[model samples]
Target: MLLRLGSLLFALPALILLVLYGVEMSAVSDCTQLGGIYNFDTAECGTEAIPQTSYYLRHSGLVNGMMLLSVLGALAMSIGMLIKGMAQQAKS
Candidate 1:
């Protein structure tokens, strides 16, 4: 019961986060879309570029870190549950 409940808590949240991350990743915007210019030291693309960067690129490290941690946590819990089951089976 404990294993099932704990796995549900971890696995469900991890799955939800993974889906959300995928959705967020799909809606990505690139600087090139604004113009060929990355930044406007002078007139660029006939206007100031403002050197804008995508939200995902700016915070990708944090996002990836969170995703990695969640995945690892879910995997760890799942493996632990499996190991416990195997032990129980061996006992029987």
Candidate 2:
């Protein structure tokens, strides 16, 4: 149970990142098809260059912190499972 949970936690961030990338790529494609520019840095769609910032970019710190926390939690859970398994093996 712990192992499964740990593995899920470990994969959660990568899954989220992939999903976000897909969404952004879709947006960029759609924007281009509609005769607009997709700004990578600001994540905006406009006819011309504009000074803008994306919500994700603005909250990058928070996002990174959450990912880091989840990874740490996954590591802890995996370690716990290992210890539990070791204890069980020693008892037999």
lDDT, each prediction: 0.59, 0.78
| lDDT per residue as tens, model 2, 1-92 | 67767777777776777687689889999999999988877677888866656646866875687588678768978797888989999999
Q: Against the true structure, candidate 2 has what lDDT?
A: 0.78
**Model 1 residue 39 distance off true place after TM-score fit, in angstroms:** 16
Per-residue error at 27 for model 2, in Å? 0.5
Per-model TM-score on C-alpha atoms: 0.42, 0.67
Per-residue accuracy of model 1 over 3-51 as CA lDDT, tens digit each: 5555665566557656865654443324346544444233234334465
Residue runs of model 2 more than 4 Å from their true location after superposition: 39-44, 51-56
What TM-score does prediction 2 earn? 0.67
